[model samples]
Target: MSTEKKTKINGINFRTDIVCYNKIGKPILLIECKSQNIKINIKTFDQLINYQSSLNANYMVITNGNKTICFNIKNNKINLIKKIPLYREV
Candidate 1:
Protein backbone atom coordinates (compact mmCIF):
# COMPACT_ATOMS: atom_id res chain seq x y z
CA MET A 1 0.00 0.00 0.00
CA SER A 2 1.11 3.54 -0.71
CA THR A 3 1.76 5.52 2.42
CA GLU A 4 0.62 8.73 0.77
CA LYS A 5 -2.68 7.27 -0.39
CA LYS A 6 -5.69 7.83 1.83
CA THR A 7 -7.35 4.54 2.81
CA LYS A 8 -10.28 5.59 4.91
CA ILE A 9 -12.68 2.71 4.74
CA ASN A 10 -16.20 2.69 6.17
CA GLY A 11 -15.49 -0.16 8.56
CA ILE A 12 -12.39 -1.20 10.39
CA ASN A 13 -9.33 -0.60 8.32
CA PHE A 14 -6.59 -3.21 8.22
CA ARG A 15 -3.17 -1.79 7.66
CA THR A 16 -2.19 -4.84 5.66
CA ASP A 17 -5.29 -4.54 3.52
CA ILE A 18 -4.73 -3.46 -0.05
CA VAL A 19 -7.33 -1.19 -1.54
CA CYS A 20 -6.75 -0.09 -5.10
CA TYR A 21 -7.96 3.01 -6.83
CA ASN A 22 -8.58 4.30 -10.32
CA LYS A 23 -6.68 7.04 -12.09
CA ILE A 24 -9.18 9.61 -10.83
CA GLY A 25 -8.57 8.43 -7.23
CA LYS A 26 -11.94 6.71 -6.98
CA PRO A 27 -11.85 3.49 -5.05
CA ILE A 28 -11.85 0.48 -7.34
CA LEU A 29 -11.07 -2.56 -5.25
CA LEU A 30 -10.68 -3.73 -1.61
CA ILE A 31 -8.61 -6.69 -0.57
CA GLU A 32 -9.26 -8.04 2.92
CA CYS A 33 -6.86 -10.27 4.76
CA LYS A 34 -8.01 -13.05 7.07
CA SER A 35 -6.11 -14.82 9.74
CA GLN A 36 -4.91 -18.32 9.04
CA ASN A 37 -6.24 -19.64 12.32
CA ILE A 38 -9.76 -18.40 11.83
CA LYS A 39 -12.02 -20.06 9.32
CA ILE A 40 -13.72 -17.77 6.83
CA ASN A 41 -17.45 -17.45 7.35
CA ILE A 42 -20.64 -15.72 6.25
CA LYS A 43 -20.37 -12.84 8.73
CA THR A 44 -16.95 -11.87 7.46
CA PHE A 45 -18.18 -12.22 3.92
CA ASP A 46 -21.05 -9.82 4.56
CA GLN A 47 -18.73 -7.33 6.20
CA LEU A 48 -16.42 -7.33 3.21
CA ILE A 49 -19.37 -6.83 0.86
CA ASN A 50 -20.67 -3.95 2.95
CA TYR A 51 -17.31 -2.27 2.98
CA GLN A 52 -17.04 -2.64 -0.77
CA SER A 53 -20.46 -1.11 -1.32
CA SER A 54 -19.74 1.76 1.03
CA LEU A 55 -16.53 2.50 -0.80
CA ASN A 56 -18.28 2.16 -4.16
CA ALA A 57 -15.54 -0.13 -5.28
CA ASN A 58 -15.85 -2.18 -8.44
CA TYR A 59 -14.31 -5.24 -6.83
CA MET A 60 -13.63 -6.83 -3.42
CA VAL A 61 -11.40 -9.64 -2.31
CA ILE A 62 -11.25 -11.90 0.75
CA THR A 63 -8.24 -13.99 1.49
CA ASN A 64 -6.93 -16.42 4.03
CA GLY A 65 -3.41 -17.71 4.20
CA ASN A 66 -3.96 -20.25 1.45
CA LYS A 67 -6.68 -18.96 -0.86
CA THR A 68 -8.29 -15.86 -2.24
CA ILE A 69 -11.69 -15.00 -3.67
CA CYS A 70 -12.54 -11.97 -5.72
CA PHE A 71 -15.94 -10.39 -6.07
CA ASN A 72 -16.51 -8.34 -9.21
CA ILE A 73 -19.14 -5.66 -9.20
CA LYS A 74 -21.06 -4.72 -12.35
CA ASN A 75 -24.55 -3.43 -13.05
CA ASN A 76 -24.92 -3.01 -9.29
CA LYS A 77 -24.46 -6.72 -8.83
CA ILE A 78 -21.63 -8.70 -7.32
CA ASN A 79 -20.27 -11.80 -8.98
CA LEU A 80 -17.41 -13.90 -7.74
CA ILE A 81 -14.40 -13.82 -9.98
CA LYS A 82 -12.43 -17.07 -9.89
CA LYS A 83 -9.16 -15.26 -10.34
CA ILE A 84 -7.63 -12.20 -8.78
CA PRO A 85 -8.85 -8.87 -10.09
CA LEU A 86 -6.51 -7.04 -12.38
CA TYR A 87 -6.09 -3.31 -11.97
CA ARG A 88 -6.12 -2.85 -15.74
CA GLU A 89 -9.50 -4.58 -16.00
CA VAL A 90 -11.31 -1.87 -14.10
Candidate 2:
Protein backbone atom coordinates (compact mmCIF):
# COMPACT_ATOMS: atom_id res chain seq x y z
CA MET A 1 0.00 0.00 0.00
CA SER A 2 1.15 3.51 -0.86
CA THR A 3 -0.22 6.67 0.62
CA GLU A 4 -0.54 9.92 -1.27
CA LYS A 5 0.72 8.40 -4.47
CA LYS A 6 1.09 10.90 -7.29
CA THR A 7 0.16 10.19 -10.90
CA LYS A 8 -0.25 12.28 -14.01
CA ILE A 9 -3.31 11.84 -16.17
CA ASN A 10 -4.53 13.91 -19.10
CA GLY A 11 -1.87 16.49 -18.40
CA ILE A 12 -2.99 16.84 -14.77
CA ASN A 13 -1.35 15.54 -11.64
CA PHE A 14 -3.41 13.82 -9.00
CA ARG A 15 -2.41 12.78 -5.50
CA THR A 16 -4.35 9.81 -4.30
CA ASP A 17 -4.62 9.07 -0.57
CA ILE A 18 -4.27 5.30 -0.56
CA VAL A 19 -3.32 3.11 -3.48
CA CYS A 20 -2.89 -0.65 -3.42
CA TYR A 21 -1.24 -2.53 -6.23
CA ASN A 22 -1.32 -6.07 -7.47
CA LYS A 23 1.69 -8.34 -7.70
CA ILE A 24 2.45 -6.97 -11.16
CA GLY A 25 2.41 -3.38 -9.84
CA LYS A 26 -0.94 -2.54 -11.36
CA PRO A 27 -3.26 -0.48 -9.15
CA ILE A 28 -6.12 -2.57 -7.80
CA LEU A 29 -7.71 -0.30 -5.25
CA LEU A 30 -7.86 3.41 -4.41
CA ILE A 31 -9.16 4.75 -1.13
CA GLU A 32 -10.04 8.20 0.16
CA CYS A 33 -10.26 9.01 3.81
CA LYS A 34 -12.33 11.66 5.53
CA SER A 35 -13.23 12.70 9.04
CA GLN A 36 -15.96 10.78 10.79
CA ASN A 37 -18.14 13.86 10.86
CA ILE A 38 -18.45 14.01 7.14
CA LYS A 39 -21.17 12.00 5.50
CA ILE A 40 -20.54 9.83 2.48
CA ASN A 41 -22.63 11.02 -0.41
CA ILE A 42 -22.72 11.62 -4.14
CA LYS A 43 -20.02 14.22 -3.91
CA THR A 44 -17.75 11.70 -2.28
CA PHE A 45 -18.48 9.21 -5.01
CA ASP A 46 -17.90 11.86 -7.64
CA GLN A 47 -14.52 12.67 -6.20
CA LEU A 48 -13.52 9.02 -6.23
CA ILE A 49 -14.82 8.70 -9.78
CA ASN A 50 -12.64 11.57 -10.86
CA TYR A 51 -9.65 10.02 -9.18
CA GLN A 52 -10.44 6.69 -10.82
CA SER A 53 -10.30 8.34 -14.22
CA SER A 54 -6.70 9.10 -13.48
CA LEU A 55 -5.68 6.06 -11.46
CA ASN A 56 -7.65 3.42 -13.40
CA ALA A 57 -8.11 1.44 -10.22
CA ASN A 58 -10.37 -1.61 -10.27
CA TYR A 59 -11.95 -0.63 -6.97
CA MET A 60 -12.68 2.68 -5.24
CA VAL A 61 -13.38 3.31 -1.57
CA ILE A 62 -14.61 6.31 0.39
CA THR A 63 -14.77 6.43 4.15
CA ASN A 64 -15.46 8.95 6.86
CA GLY A 65 -13.83 6.80 9.52
CA ASN A 66 -17.25 5.60 10.63
CA LYS A 67 -18.94 4.58 7.39
CA THR A 68 -17.22 3.13 4.35
CA ILE A 69 -18.43 2.56 0.86
CA CYS A 70 -16.77 0.50 -1.81
CA PHE A 71 -17.33 0.37 -5.51
CA ASN A 72 -16.30 -1.99 -8.27
CA ILE A 73 -15.43 -0.44 -11.59
CA LYS A 74 -15.94 -2.49 -14.74
CA ASN A 75 -16.70 -1.55 -18.31
CA ASN A 76 -16.83 2.12 -17.30
CA LYS A 77 -19.55 1.42 -14.77
CA ILE A 78 -19.48 1.68 -10.97
CA ASN A 79 -21.25 -0.81 -8.76
CA LEU A 80 -21.60 -0.54 -5.00
CA ILE A 81 -20.12 -3.31 -2.90
CA LYS A 82 -20.91 -4.47 0.61
CA LYS A 83 -17.40 -4.26 2.02
CA ILE A 84 -13.76 -4.07 1.21
CA PRO A 85 -12.16 -7.31 0.15
CA LEU A 86 -9.60 -8.96 2.37
CA TYR A 87 -5.95 -8.71 1.37
CA ARG A 88 -5.77 -12.41 0.54
CA GLU A 89 -8.96 -12.13 -1.47
CA VAL A 90 -7.56 -9.21 -3.39
Candidate 3:
Protein backbone atom coordinates (compact mmCIF):
# COMPACT_ATOMS: atom_id res chain seq x y z
CA MET A 1 0.00 0.00 0.00
CA SER A 2 1.15 3.52 -0.79
CA THR A 3 -0.14 7.03 -0.71
CA GLU A 4 0.32 9.65 -3.36
CA LYS A 5 1.47 7.04 -5.82
CA LYS A 6 2.69 8.51 -9.07
CA THR A 7 1.39 7.05 -12.34
CA LYS A 8 1.57 7.88 -16.00
CA ILE A 9 -1.13 7.62 -18.61
CA ASN A 10 -0.80 8.83 -22.16
CA GLY A 11 2.37 10.67 -21.29
CA ILE A 12 0.72 12.53 -18.44
CA ASN A 13 1.63 12.03 -14.81
CA PHE A 14 -0.90 11.79 -11.98
CA ARG A 15 -0.68 11.35 -8.24
CA THR A 16 -3.31 9.12 -6.69
CA ASP A 17 -3.90 9.54 -2.96
CA ILE A 18 -3.74 5.85 -2.18
CA VAL A 19 -2.93 2.67 -4.04
CA CYS A 20 -2.94 -0.91 -2.82
CA TYR A 21 -1.33 -3.72 -4.69
CA ASN A 22 -1.63 -7.46 -4.87
CA LYS A 23 1.07 -10.03 -4.16
CA ILE A 24 2.23 -9.91 -7.76
CA GLY A 25 2.75 -6.13 -7.52
CA LYS A 26 -0.27 -5.12 -9.57
CA PRO A 27 -2.41 -2.28 -8.31
CA ILE A 28 -5.77 -3.60 -7.15
CA LEU A 29 -7.27 -0.47 -5.69
CA LEU A 30 -7.00 3.26 -6.15
CA ILE A 31 -8.31 5.86 -3.74
CA GLU A 32 -8.63 9.60 -3.98
CA CYS A 33 -8.94 11.62 -0.81
CA LYS A 34 -10.40 15.05 -0.35
CA SER A 35 -10.92 17.33 2.61
CA GLN A 36 -14.13 16.96 4.60
CA ASN A 37 -15.40 20.23 3.21
CA ILE A 38 -15.45 18.81 -0.27
CA LYS A 39 -18.22 16.45 -1.26
CA ILE A 40 -17.74 13.49 -3.54
CA ASN A 41 -19.56 14.01 -6.81
CA ILE A 42 -19.72 13.08 -10.45
CA LYS A 43 -16.57 14.97 -11.23
CA THR A 44 -14.77 13.09 -8.54
CA PHE A 45 -15.97 9.82 -10.02
CA ASP A 46 -14.83 10.90 -13.45
CA GLN A 47 -11.34 11.62 -12.23
CA LEU A 48 -11.03 8.20 -10.71
CA ILE A 49 -12.38 6.59 -13.85
CA ASN A 50 -9.73 8.38 -15.84
CA TYR A 51 -7.03 7.13 -13.54
CA GLN A 52 -8.36 3.59 -13.68
CA SER A 53 -7.29 3.02 -17.27
CA SER A 54 -3.66 3.44 -16.40
CA LEU A 55 -3.76 1.92 -12.96
CA ASN A 56 -5.72 -1.17 -14.08
CA ALA A 57 -7.47 -1.17 -10.76
CA ASN A 58 -10.30 -3.49 -9.82
CA TYR A 59 -11.80 -0.92 -7.47
CA MET A 60 -11.81 2.86 -7.12
CA VAL A 61 -12.69 4.94 -4.09
CA ILE A 62 -13.27 8.60 -3.35
CA THR A 63 -13.46 9.98 0.14
CA ASN A 64 -13.77 13.29 1.85
CA GLY A 65 -12.72 11.95 5.28
CA ASN A 66 -16.39 11.99 6.32
CA LYS A 67 -18.00 10.17 3.45
CA THR A 68 -16.74 7.46 1.14
CA ILE A 69 -17.85 6.06 -2.17
CA CYS A 70 -16.55 2.86 -3.67
CA PHE A 71 -16.86 1.54 -7.18
CA ASN A 72 -16.22 -1.75 -8.88
CA ILE A 73 -14.83 -1.59 -12.39
CA LYS A 74 -15.47 -4.35 -14.90
CA ASN A 75 -15.36 -4.22 -18.66
CA ASN A 76 -14.73 -0.51 -18.24
CA LYS A 77 -18.00 -0.03 -16.41
CA ILE A 78 -18.31 1.57 -12.98
CA ASN A 79 -20.80 0.42 -10.38
CA LEU A 80 -21.21 2.01 -6.95
CA ILE A 81 -20.95 0.06 -3.76
CA LYS A 82 -22.32 0.91 -0.33
CA LYS A 83 -18.99 0.79 1.44
CA ILE A 84 -15.35 -0.07 1.16
CA PRO A 85 -14.70 -3.73 1.59
CA LEU A 86 -12.39 -5.34 4.10
CA TYR A 87 -8.87 -6.10 2.89
CA ARG A 88 -9.65 -9.81 2.84
CA GLU A 89 -12.58 -9.15 0.54
CA VAL A 90 -10.41 -7.39 -1.94
Candidate 4:
Protein backbone atom coordinates (compact mmCIF):
# COMPACT_ATOMS: atom_id res chain seq x y z
CA MET A 1 0.00 0.00 0.00
CA SER A 2 1.09 3.56 -0.71
CA THR A 3 0.09 6.81 0.92
CA GLU A 4 -0.52 10.13 -0.77
CA LYS A 5 -1.71 13.61 0.11
CA LYS A 6 -5.03 14.28 -1.57
CA THR A 7 -7.44 17.17 -1.66
CA LYS A 8 -11.21 16.77 -1.52
CA ILE A 9 -14.28 18.95 -1.14
CA ASN A 10 -13.97 18.46 2.61
CA GLY A 11 -10.25 19.30 2.91
CA ILE A 12 -6.72 18.08 2.41
CA ASN A 13 -5.32 15.05 4.21
CA PHE A 14 -3.07 12.02 3.85
CA ARG A 15 -4.60 8.73 2.81
CA THR A 16 -2.66 6.01 4.58
CA ASP A 17 -3.49 2.99 2.43
CA ILE A 18 -4.61 2.64 -1.18
CA VAL A 19 -3.85 0.49 -4.19
CA CYS A 20 -1.47 2.13 -6.63
CA TYR A 21 -2.84 3.75 -9.71
CA ASN A 22 -1.70 3.00 -13.23
CA LYS A 23 -1.00 6.67 -13.89
CA ILE A 24 0.04 9.57 -11.73
CA GLY A 25 -1.82 12.89 -11.98
CA LYS A 26 -5.16 14.65 -12.45
CA PRO A 27 -8.10 12.31 -11.71
CA ILE A 28 -7.45 9.18 -9.60
CA LEU A 29 -9.11 5.90 -8.65
CA LEU A 30 -9.34 4.61 -5.07
CA ILE A 31 -9.14 0.86 -4.78
CA GLU A 32 -9.74 -1.04 -1.54
CA CYS A 33 -8.46 -4.58 -1.54
CA LYS A 34 -9.35 -7.30 0.93
CA SER A 35 -7.42 -10.43 1.72
CA GLN A 36 -8.89 -13.84 1.01
CA ASN A 37 -8.80 -14.79 4.66
CA ILE A 38 -11.01 -11.89 5.60
CA LYS A 39 -14.76 -11.81 5.22
CA ILE A 40 -16.39 -8.96 3.34
CA ASN A 41 -19.52 -7.33 4.70
CA ILE A 42 -21.50 -4.14 5.05
CA LYS A 43 -18.95 -2.52 7.37
CA THR A 44 -16.30 -2.85 4.72
CA PHE A 45 -18.63 -1.34 2.15
CA ASP A 46 -19.38 1.56 4.46
CA GLN A 47 -15.70 2.18 4.99
CA LEU A 48 -15.05 2.20 1.26
CA ILE A 49 -17.91 4.61 0.71
CA ASN A 50 -16.57 6.95 3.38
CA TYR A 51 -13.11 6.89 1.91
CA GLN A 52 -14.45 7.47 -1.58
CA SER A 53 -16.50 10.38 -0.35
CA SER A 54 -13.52 11.92 1.44
CA LEU A 55 -11.23 11.45 -1.52
CA ASN A 56 -13.88 12.81 -3.86
CA ALA A 57 -12.91 10.35 -6.51
CA ASN A 58 -14.85 9.96 -9.74
CA TYR A 59 -14.57 6.18 -9.46
CA MET A 60 -14.12 3.74 -6.58
CA VAL A 61 -13.74 -0.02 -6.20
CA ILE A 62 -13.92 -2.60 -3.42
CA THR A 63 -12.63 -6.08 -4.03
CA ASN A 64 -11.78 -9.32 -2.39
CA GLY A 65 -9.66 -11.89 -4.22
CA ASN A 66 -12.79 -13.23 -5.92
CA LYS A 67 -15.35 -10.43 -6.18
CA THR A 68 -15.32 -6.76 -7.08
CA ILE A 69 -17.78 -3.92 -6.73
CA CYS A 70 -17.44 -0.56 -8.45
CA PHE A 71 -19.13 2.77 -8.01
CA ASN A 72 -19.35 5.87 -10.16
CA ILE A 73 -20.52 9.22 -8.84
CA LYS A 74 -22.32 11.45 -11.34
CA ASN A 75 -24.82 14.28 -11.12
CA ASN A 76 -24.65 13.79 -7.34
CA LYS A 77 -25.93 10.22 -7.64
CA ILE A 78 -23.88 7.10 -7.19
CA ASN A 79 -24.24 4.46 -9.85
CA LEU A 80 -23.01 0.97 -9.10
CA ILE A 81 -21.51 -0.61 -12.16
CA LYS A 82 -21.06 -4.31 -12.84
CA LYS A 83 -17.36 -3.82 -13.45
CA ILE A 84 -14.83 -1.16 -12.67
CA PRO A 85 -16.36 1.85 -14.34
CA LEU A 86 -14.37 4.50 -16.19
CA TYR A 87 -14.58 8.21 -15.67
CA ARG A 88 -16.05 8.71 -19.14
CA GLU A 89 -18.85 6.29 -18.22
CA VAL A 90 -19.62 8.18 -15.02
Off by over 4 Å in 1: 1-16
> Which of the predicted structures, 1 or 4, would earn the higher TM-score when compared with the native?
1
Candidate 2 per-residue C-alpha lDDT over 1-90 given as tens digits, one digit per residue, 9 for 90 to 100: 899878786788878889999998888999999888888988987778888887788888999989888988878888889999876667
- Give the winner by TM-score: 2 or 4: 2
Query: Residues 3-28, candidate 4, lDDT per residue (tens digit)?
Result: 54453534645352464343555345
Per-model clash counts, in order, read 0, 0, 0, 0
Global Cα lDDT for candidate 3 = 0.86
Which lDDT value does model 3 have at 16?
88
By TM-score: ranked, best first: 3, 2, 1, 4
**TM-score of each model, in listed order:** 0.78, 0.86, 0.89, 0.65
Q: What TM-score does model 4 achieve against the real structure? A: 0.65
For model 3, where is the 10-residue window of minimal lDDT?
Answer: 81-90
Question: 34-55 in candidate 3: lDDT tens per residue?
Answer: 8899888889877887888888
The full ranking of all candidates by lDDT, starting with the best, is: 2, 3, 1, 4
Q: What is the C-alpha local distance difference test score of each model?
A: 0.73, 0.86, 0.86, 0.66
TM-score: model 1 vs. ground truth: 0.78
